[model samples]
Structures are given as structure tokens and as C-alpha cells.
Target chain A: MSDKLISLLSGIIFGIGLVISGMTNPEKVLSFLSISHSWSAEYKWDYSLIFVMGGAIITAAPFFYFLKNKEVSSLGLKISLPAKQDIDKKLVIGASLFGVGWGLVGFCPGPAISAIAVFDPIVLVFLVSMAVGVLVKQNIIK
Target chain B: MTDFTPYSALVGGIIIGLSVVFYFFTTGRLAGISGIFENAITNSVNRFSNLFFLLGLVVGPLLYYNVIAPKVSIAFNITDSYTLIILGGLLVGFGTRLGGGCTSGHGICGIGRLSTSSIIATVIFVTTGMLTVTILQQFGIYL
Candidate 1:
């Protein structure tokens, strides 16, 4: 298969996983984030996020470890991983902003993209805004 | 909890992990959505493949809802307010770019590789996310 095809397949499978895991649902995500609500009698905190992350981590860790020392992948493509090891200010500030947004709307990039299939107006708005945000960061916020 | 779906969540997570592995094996690239999206937009290298991957993200859920599980309707019960949605989107987009990766990138693939930066990113994001929810709740802002 061509590289593009492989990428397409990988994305499809990833999207399916997101949908199946209920990550595409903003309400579900918010429920998981709202841990304080677990004690509330009216609302129940969702634990699916924990299970989903745990399952993915467990399944992918071995492969990552195995490939740690390899220069190339099974298909002969040169492997490329992030090499940055330092925990810098940019990382901390950026993550904090992302977290606040996620908690506020329960929409992250992956799920936001997946939610496009739903044909909701709000999703479109959010996506367009997200694109603008990216553009701003890349071009203006250097 | 009334909305728990442990079995499906685990199954879905495993599928996600496998997808990341498959991507790495075939393309020798991490399946980090934000990175892919960012590169697809700003950089020309592997732009087509990145776009295809993003296209697949949309198509995957489309196929699932329309064919594989027609009974499961896609729903977003969260707030329909455009102001909040746009704000959240901007933050997520800017933050992911500035920070390096989002949930899939930092939470799954990053941690999977045991990257220290990724681990710290994940902890910060998750903790802040929970704190955001708590703060919002205190103000009666149920999103």
C-alpha cells in the first residue's frame, strides 16, 4: 500500500476508536473531566476516559519500547520521533491552555475533527475557529 | 455511573493503539493528530498523506455511524453556544501547537513511548482540565 493509503487507514481506525470510546461526545468528555461531580448525587462521573487511555497506553508501550533502538520501521521507512527532552515553558503554558479549553468545551482536535461527520453547525464553527487559532499561532505568535 | 461503557472504551482504546502502531510500522511516523494537522497546513512535506489521514478521521466516524452502527446516533449534548465553542477551539489549537501535541499525541502516543516531556504534558493537561471543570462547576457553568 502507498504511504497515503496507510495514513488514511490509520486515521480511519483512529477515528473509529475515538467514536467507539465515546471521546467524540463533548458531554461524555466533560463528564469525565468533571471529577468533582462524582460525589454529587445528581451526576455520575464517567470513568471511560481512564480506561481508554489505560488500554491504549498498555497496548502501545511494548511496541514503542521494541522500536526504541530501531532506525527504521518494519516497512523500511525511517522512523521519526520527537527528540526534545526538556520540559520548557512553552510546553507547560501551551498544555495548560489546551486543558482549560478542553475542560470548557470538551472538544479536542481529534474528536473535533471526528465530530465533523455529524454535520453540526457548532462543530463547523469550532473547527474554523481552531484553524484560525493555528494560523495565528504559526504566523503571528512566533 | 449511568454513562459508563468500560468494555467498548477498552476495545476502542486498543483499536486506537493498534492504529498508532500500524501508522508507525508503515509510515515510520507517530500518529499524533495535532502534529499531522499542523504540518498538513503549514508544511509541504508529506502534506498529501497528512491530509489523507485527516480525511480518514472524518470518514471513519461517518462510516461507523452510517454503516457499522446505524443505531448509535451521533450526539453532542454539550452547549450549543458558539462563543464558548470558538473560544475552546482557539485555545486547543493554539495550545496544541505551542505545547507540541494534544490528547492523542501527548496522552496516547507520547506516554506510550515513555517520553518525559510527553508525560509532563499529559499530567499538566489532565490536571488543568479537571481543575477547569471544577472551577466552571463552582460558577454553575455546566457545559
Candidate 2:
């Protein structure tokens, strides 16, 4: 099949998995990260978060295997991976900010967008600001 | 919604992993969150790849909620909504551009592929996450 067809199929499957797994629920995510959550209190120690992560790992196994044999792209061009390997100022500062936002809101951009499907206003604001931020960083500043 | 299943998490993770692999298979892309966003904005990489990758990110949850399960509750303090909207937006966007990717780019796709930049990036992401949580706690902010 064409690349677009494959991506659409992949996206549908992924969306179904997210809904089935309850990763869309920020409460579940927060409780999983914390030892003490009223939600977790009722729910048996659900480390399914790890499983979701693990599932992703398992799914990518084939890719790794392929990489082992074919480290370079098929087109005979060098893989354009990032070259800089330093823990520079940019990484430190940005990660700090991301972590703060993630901790406080229990919503990252991925899940935040999903929350929009649930009609959550908070997520809408997040989406708007995030889009604006992207614009500012790419366009206005540049 | 108290439909509890431990196996689902495993399945979910597997699905994510598979998606990453699929991403690479079709697009020759690494499935890095930051890279996807960058492509979306810059219009340099394949627009189709960016659209589909982002679509997966969004649809992943919708399918889970509507089809697989019935109810999902998320407890968020509306009082902090404004703060979250502004600061979180600026930080993540700035971080992604500056660091060249997000957690997925560094933590999952980057580390998995054994990229040095991803390794350093992951460390910074984790360390900053810890520090941010600590600072928030110190200020008597509970979320």
C-alpha cells in the first residue's frame, strides 16, 4: 500500500489503543506517577502505565532488528539524525519548563489534544497556546 | 469507569512501539515527537507524514474513549487552567524547537535508536521534570 494509506491505518489502530488503554484520562496518569492518589486508592496497584509503555517498546522491536541489519537508509544516503550530542543550555532550560508544565497540569501536548475529544476546555486553551507558541518560535522570532 | 485490566497497558505500550516502527517503515522517520512538530511548522519534511503522525497522536485517545471503554474521568484544577495554558504552551514549544524534539523524540525514539543527542536530551528532560515537580511542591501547589 501507499505510505499515506499505511499511516492512516496506523493512526486508527493507535487511536483505538489509546481509548482502550485509558491513557486519555489524566487522573489515571497522575495516579500512576504518584504513590498516593484517591483514584489509585480504589484501584488496585495498576502499573498498566508500564505496560502501555512496554507495548510501545515491543511494537518497535522489528524496527530495531531492521536497524541492526540495515543501519543506514535504503536510498544509500546517510541518515539525517541529529549530530549535536551535548547537554547544552537549550536542552536544560526547555526540559525544565516542559517538566514543570507536565507536573502541574498532568497534561502533555499529546494527551492534551486527546482531551479535546472529550470536550475539555482546559485542553482547548492548552491547544491554542501551544499552537501560538509554535508560531511565535518559528515565525515571529525568526 | 472502573473497567480495570492490567494487560491493556501492555497492549497500549506495544501499540505505541508498533506505531513507531510503522512510522519508520513507511516514512523513514524516527517518530520523534519534536521532529513531527517541527515538520508540521516548517513544511520541509513530507507534509503527509506530519499530518498522519499528528493524526495518530490525536486519534489514539479518541478511539480508546469512544469504542474501547465507556467513561473516563480526568481530575484537573480549573483554577490553574490559565497558568497551564500560557506557561505550558510557551515552554513546550520553546523546548521542542531549542532541544530539537520532545520527550518522545529523546526518551523513546531517540534512546531506542541509540542517538547521542537523544541521550543527552532525555537526561535533561528527566532532570528538569524532577526539578519542576520539586519546585511546585515546595510552593504548596498540589495537582
Candidate 3:
């Protein structure tokens, strides 16, 4: 199929996965992050997040390993994996900040995108702010 | 205690993995949602594909909710405060861009490829995320 079509299909599948995995649910995500809650009888820490990651890793790791050296994909496009390998301050600081945001609302990029279908007013606000944040990083912050 | 859905989580995750693999196979690119979204706005090359992907992402859940399973309700319990939501969005947007990837890129696709930077990024974000939650709960500020 065409590249655009393929991309569209992949995104749909990914979105469905996010919904099924409960990643779209902020409460469930918060529960997963609140590991300490597991110790309290009144609260139960959800292990669904771990299982989701584990499932994705197990399913994708072998494929990636095999394709590591491949220069071209099945569609004859050049394989474009990330080239940067350094664990620098940018990565650390940025990730820390992202984590804080995620913990605050339990909305990451993937889940946030998927949650758009819910038509929640908060989702629209978050998305617009997120876009502005990206612009700030690319233009002002840099 | 009542919200655990391990089986569905695993199944959904595997499906996500497959989508990542499929995207790679077709476009020879990693299916990083942040990167895709960023490029869709700023970059020109492959912008159409990125847009299409995002369109599909939105459509996916709609289709599921409207057709696949109409009875299933989506549980979304986030804070009603618009201020917190907006702040969280800004942080996530800026952080993901500055860091070069988000959960899909660094956590799943990156880790699967065994990239060192991705692994470190994932570790930091996940740990920090947990810490943030823990600290917030300590303050009795559960969102």
C-alpha cells in the first residue's frame, strides 16, 4: 500500500491498542504510577501498565533486533532509526519534565492523542497547550 | 483494586507493537507519536503521512466506540481543573520535543531497538513519573 495509507493504518491500530490497554484512562494511569498505593488496603496499584510495556517489548524486540542492520525496509524506503546514542543532560532534564506532566494528569502524547475522540474539553486545552509547548521548545527554548 | 485488566492490556500492547512494526516496515521509520506530531507541524517531508497517521489515530477509537463495542464506556477520570491540564500539556509538549521522543519513541520503539539513549530516557521518565505521583499523593493532591 501507499506510505500514507500504511501510516494511517498503523496509527489506527496503535490508537486501538492504547484504548484497550487502558492507557487512555487517566485514573488507571495514575493508579499505575502510584506504586505506593499497592501497599495500602484501600488502594490497589494497577499492574496493567507494566504488562502493556512488557507485551510490546516482547513482541517488537526480536523484529527490531533482526532489522537493526537493515538499510532498507520492506517498502524499499531507507530505514531511518535514531542516530543519537548519547544519554545527555537534554534527555535527562526533558524526560524528567515530561514525567512530571504525565504524573500530574496521566496524559502522555500517545494517550492524549487517542483520547481526542472522547471530545473532552480538557483534552482540547491540553492539546493546544502541548502544541504551544512544542513551539516554545523549538523556537524560544532553543 | 477493581480496575485491573491485565489480559486486555497485554493484548492491546501487542497490537501497538504490531502497529509499530508495520509502520517501520512501510515507511522505514519509527512510529514515535511525538516525533510524528512534531514533524506534522514543523517539518515538510513526510508531513502528509504524519497527518494521515494522526487522523487515523483519532479515528481508531471512534470506530471502536461507535461500532466495535458500543456498550463499553471509556473511563477517563482526570482533574477538572483547566489550569493543571494546560500546564501538564505544556510540560509534556516541551519535554517530549526537547528530549527527542516520548513513550512510544523512547519507551517502546527505542527500547525494542536496544538504543542506549532511549533506554536511559525511558528509565528517567518512568522513574520520575512514579516519583511525581508518589509525592503528589503524599501531599493529598490526587488527580
Candidate 4:
């Protein structure tokens, strides 16, 4: 099998996994983040988010440990693990903006893309806008 | 209705994580979404890496749903889909380019590869998510 084929398949599986895990649902995610307004009337702080994050970590932990000991390329590009650890203004500002955006929308790129399976116009719009954003930042803004 | 199972997530996550490992072992690659996507679209790198990465991502959920319990459902307001999606898209797109990767790249791949840059990027992504919620709530838009 070709690598491209495998990548595409993996992405599809990843999307399906997101859907099953309720990662695609912004409400569930938002509730997971802040229990104050979760639709679950009798909700305490939802630990589902922790589970999901933990799930993601557990899923990758072993391999990561193995890879940590080696020098390997990633996605066909040589991995460059940065040495300088500086939290500059750009990092802070960017992270702040990103958090605000995520909190408001309840969807990130990963889950949002998976939501395409729902065939909702809103998801379509989100994806288009996202692509346009990428285009602008990459081309127009540059 | 039983409460959610934290361990289920563990199982699912382990599967996904192992998939990432398998991806690396087989293709000698890291399963970073943005990087794989960038290469796929730009045709800048080997086409195989991009293909398998995307494939693993797509198929992962199907296997989980079929083999694992299928009670999980994604719940969200569909009414404001357009506005939310558009806003989300723009922000993510901009962030990915500015920070140089998405959550998967930094959070999953970068963290796995032990790259400081990936760690920084992941922090930015998480912080962004948190802040987005706070600001939206302040403006009464999060609802």
C-alpha cells in the first residue's frame, strides 16, 4: 500500500474516532471544559475531557517513548526538536487568541474536520473559512 | 443511563496512540495532522506519508464504533453552525500558520517526537482554546 493511501485512511479513522468519542460535539466538549452550563442538568465537573486527553496520551505514549530515543523523520520530513525554550510575546498572544476562539466555538480544526461527516452547512462554512484563513495567512498576508 | 466511562477513553486513546506508533514504525513518520496535510496539498513531500496519515485518521473512529460500544454521540448546537464554523476555521487556519502546526502536530506528533517547538505549539493551542471560551462567555456568545 502507498503511504498517501495509508495517511488518508488514518485520517478517516481519526475522524470516526473523534465522532465516536463525542469530540465532534462542541456542546459536549464545552461542557467538558466548563461544567457550569453543560446540558447535563445534574452535572459536576465533567472528567470526560480528562479521559479523552488521557486517551490520546495513552494511545501514543509507548511509541513516543521509543521514538524519543532515536533520530527519525516525521511525515517524510526530518524532525527538528527545538532547543531554545523561550515563551516570547508572540507565543503568549497567539495562545490567548487561540483559547478565546476555541472557547467561543467549541470546535477545533481536528473535530471540526471530522464533523464533515455530519454534512452540515455550518461545518462546511467553518471548513471553507478555515481554508480561506490558511490561504490568506499563507499567501495574501504574506 | 450510566455515567460516562473514563476508562473507555483510555482504551480508545491507546488504540489511537498505537496507531500513531504503527504509522511511525511502518513509514518512519510522525502522525502530525497539519504537516501531513501541508505536504499532501502542496505536494512538497512523498505522497505516501500524507496518504497513510490521513487514512489512519479516518478509519480510526469506524473501528472503535463497530468494535467498541456505540453509545457515544457528538452533541452540539446546529443552529449557529455557519457562524461558529467560519469563525473556527479562520482562527485555526491563522493559528496553524502562525504557530507552524496544529494540535496534532504539536500535541501528538511533536510531543511524541520530544520537540520543544511542538511543546510550545501545543501550549499555544490549548491556551487558545481556553481563552476562546472565556472571551466568548464574556460577550455572551459562548452559549
Candidate 5:
């Protein structure tokens, strides 16, 4: 089909996956990341993220590997993967910053976006702030 | 109340993996959320597709909540102060772009591709997030 339709389908699947995996639930995320909290909890740690990521990686990894080997995907289109693979200062620093944000809010972008359907006002604030942050990066920081 | 859902999460994860596979085979593009958001902001050639993808993220969950799992509300709560929430969003947004990808791009898609940078980024970020929580807990900080 069309590129937009394909992406939309992909996004829909991802959204449902986040909800089914409980990644859309802030409390689930908080517990997963809460080192001390997990120690006190009955479950030890919410390994849902591990399960989810493992599921995704196992199913997707081999497929992508084979696709990357080819100059083009099954659709006869060239695969576009990020070329930069260096572990530079920006990589570490930026990821650290993201981690801090994640730890603070119990959200990364995907979950944040999925949580939007919950109809919480706080989510709106977070979304606006995220957009602003991107704006700052493009306009002021760079 | 919340409970562990290891099996459901794994099921969801397989769907995620399949989605990535579909995106790759059909569109020939990595299904990175942050990259799509970035494209939307930068007015890239595929910005409209990015919008479509993101909109689907919202619509899909809405349909599931309303139709599939009405009993599962997945209560929304973050004890962090409003200031922290806003600040956290900004940091996540800027950081993901600067670092090249967020959890999905770097954590899942990046690692799947075996990109060294994604592997390193994933390790560093996850460790840092855990450390941040650990340190804050020690400091009697709630956020």
C-alpha cells in the first residue's frame, strides 16, 4: 500500500502493544524503573519491560538483520537505517538526559504518546513541554 | 490496582516486533518513534507519514481501551510535581534527538540492528535511569 498507510498501521500496532504491555501505565513504568521500590514490592521487579523488549527483539531482530543484508527490502525499496554508530559524547550525554527524564516522569516518547488516549491533563503538559524541548534543540541549542 | 502481566507484555512485544518487520518490509524505514517526531518537526520529506504514524498511536489505544479492554483502565498517576513533569518532558525530547533515538529507536530498533551506538546508548541510558532512581530514593526524594 501507500507509505502513509503502512506507517499508520505500524503506529497502530505499536500503540496497542504499549497498552497491552502496560507500558502506557505510568505506575507500571515507575515500578519497573524504581530500584528501591522493586525491592520492597511483592513481585521483586516488574519485568514486563524485559518481557516486552525481549519479545520485540527476538521477533524483529532476525528479520531486520536479513533485510539489512539486502540492498533493498522485500518491497524493492532501499532500507534506510541510521548510519552513525559511534559512541560519542552526544550519545552518552543525550541518553543520560533522557534517562533522567524517564526516571522522573515514567515516560519515554512512545509511552507518552500512547498515554495521551487516557485523557489526563498532565499528559498534555508533558506533550507540550516535549514539543517545546524539540523546538529549543532545533532553534536555540543548535 | 496494578499487577504483573509478564505474559501479556510478551504477547504485546511480539506484535511490536511484527510491526517493525512490517514497517521494514513495506516502507523500508526504521520504526523509530523519536525519529518520526523529529521528522515532523524538521519538515522532512516524510513528515506527513510521521504524522500518520503518530496519529495511529493515539487511535489504536483509544480503540483498544473502548472496545477490547474496557475493564482495564490502566490508571494514570505521576507523583512528581508539575514542574518535574514539564522539565522531564523537555529533557526527554531534547535528549532523544541529540542522542539519535529514544527507547524505541535506540532500545529496540537500534539494538535489533546491532548498531554499536544504539547498544551503547541503550546501556548508558537504562543504567543512568536506574541510577537516577536509586540515588533519588537514597536521598529521600520522591520524584
Candidate 6:
């Protein structure tokens, strides 16, 4: 129960951050991606997401470094770091596909959930489709 | 509307960082949203925890919406029809799992930890995303 509650709170913070940072808005994300164009208008180059992401990494990195030294977490949960260290085809292909999708819609999983916070037919469609996609991938791999 | 709110963005990010840090310290796991979502659906991870975490994501906005009902806005419509949205969703779904993480996983937690694979993955995704947008613009076409 404690674990569930903590993760729930964590999700809350994350969602709040996403919304406040404008990442949940497809338009803002679209502008950020538009930066790929050299002639994009100055206002169209939205780097606010960068500030949000950078702030997050800056604040979290030191604690993560501290966590690296310990076996159990500060709260006594077992350390669950990923064991996989390989860079293989799946990683590249999957990431590449994700990038394309994101450029197309600016709705990667995290912000897609953030998009849902506002309620839209399109966001729901994306969620259901993405879920189905994950299921498809799982079945194929196994 | 096109203006960027740097202060709010930065502060909100710090709050998010704090939450993720707490998540790691308490759960001993990185807060990779997509990974958790995938694991929950597949029954590959602690389904209850992941479910509740995702549930919290919904509840958080609901709570905030009580105070501020922000109108949803879109700057660029990627496509005129639902086809693009559907296609984007399919690719995201397959690619995130295939790639092993998403923005939150590889972009935030993975890069923070200095994981070589995460960094490489991030670079690839960002590059592809840039190329996708650039190419579409060049061709005056969008999918």
C-alpha cells in the first residue's frame, strides 16, 4: 500500500510538471520539434521544455548518484536498477520509430498521458492505439 | 500563447525532479512512465503499483483542473485527419517498448544516470524526430 501510494504521488508530481511546463500541449511540443527547421520563427522555437527537462535532471542527478552507492533505497525498497547494458537493434529501431511518431504528433507516451489530462478524442485515440501497440509488440517478442 | 513561461516551466520541472527522486529513493526504481505503462498492461511488472502510478497521473490533473480549467490548445495540426494520429500512436507504442524506454525513461532517468545506451537512444530518437519534422516541412507533406 505504501509503495502504491508513493508511486501515485510521484505520478501526480510528474503530471503536474508536464502540464505546467506546457509539454501536455501538442502545439507547444509541435513548436519545439519545429526547431529542426533553421528558418523557424523566433517565437516558434519553444525551448521551455528544455528548461523543464534540464531542471529535472539537475535536481535528480545528485540523489541518483547517492542511490547508486546503496543496496536498498532510503525507504527500504530493494534496488531495482536495470541489468541490461546492451545497445542493440531493438533499441535503435524502436527509438527511431518513436521519434518519427513524436515528430508527427508530438505526443510521446508521457505527454500523451498529459494530453489526456485535458480530455480530447484524439488523445483517447492515441492512448488506446498505443496500448494496443504495446500488446502487439509483447506478443511478437514472446 | 506562443510565449514560453520559463519560470513556471523550470519550477515545475524541479517539482517533477523531486517526485522522481522520491520515487527512486522509496521504490528503488526509475520513474519511466512508458515502461511502467507497458509492464502493467503486459503483467511483466508489479501491475498494481504501475496501475496506481498511472492512475495518479489522471487524478493529478483532475485535482488541478478543479482550480484552473485551462483550455486545450493546438499550434500545429500534424494532419488534417485521424490517420496521422493513429499512425503516430502505433509507431510510439511499438517504438517505445522496442526501444526500451520513452521520454521519461531514456530521456530523463536514463540520461541522468549517464547510461551509454540511454544516451545513444536519446540521440537517435531526437535525430529521427528532427528529421521527420524537417522532411515533412521540406516536402510540404505530413503523415
**Would you estimate the TM-scores of all the predictions?**
0.96, 0.77, 0.96, 0.77, 0.93, 0.91
Q: Quality of candidate 5's docking, in CAPRI categories?
A: medium
RMSD (Å) of each candidate, 1 decimal: 1.4, 4.3, 1.3, 4.2, 2.0, 2.6
Model 4 lDDT on a 0 to 1 scale:
0.60
Candidate 3 residues lying further than 4 Å off, grouped into runs, are: none
Give per-residue CA lDDT, model 3, range B49-112, as digits (tens): 9999998888889988989889999777787878778988999999998898999999999999
Q: lDDT for model 6, on a 0 to 1 scale?
A: 0.79
> TM-score, chain B only, every model?
0.94, 0.81, 0.95, 0.76, 0.90, 0.83
**Model 2 TM-score (2 dp):** 0.77
| Alpha-carbon deviation at A104 in model 3, angstroms | 0.8
Candidate 2 residues A53-129, lDDT tens each?
Answer: 55665567557666745545543434455565577676666666666555555555556655666776777777677
Instruction: List the per-model TM-score of the A chain.
Output: 0.93, 0.69, 0.95, 0.78, 0.90, 0.90
Give the per-residue lDDT digits (tens) of candidate 4, residues A29-138.
Answer: 66555644345476555556556656776667666776655565454545444444356655555545545556656666677666655556777787677667666666
Query: lDDT tens digits, residues A1-142, model 5?
Result: 7888888989999999888888887777766777665667545666578888889988999998777766776667777877876788888889999898888778889989888898888988998898887777778656
User: Which scores greater on DockQ, model 1 or model 6?
Assistant: 1
Candidate 3 at A141: error in angstroms?
A: 4.5
Better of 4 and 6 by DockQ: 6
Q: Write model 1 residue lDDT over B1-143, tens digit each, in one string.
A: 23988998999999899999889878889998988988998899999999999999999999899999999977667677777888999989899998999998999999998889999999999889999989988988877
Q: Per-residue CA lDDT of candidate 1, range A1-142, in tens? A: 8898999999999999999998888988888888887798887778799898888889898998988888887668888988875799989999999999898899889899999888888888888888887888898767
How would you encode candidate 3's per-residue C-alpha lDDT over A83-128 as one tens digit per residue? 8767878899999999988988899998898899999888889989
Candidate achieving the largest TM-score: 3
Regions of candidate 6 where Cα sits further than 4 Å from its true position? A36-38, A41-43, B68-80, B139-143
The better candidate by lDDT, 3 or 5, is 3
DockQ of each: 0.78, 0.42, 0.80, 0.43, 0.71, 0.66
Off by over 4 Å in 5: A37-43, A74-76, A140-142, B139-143
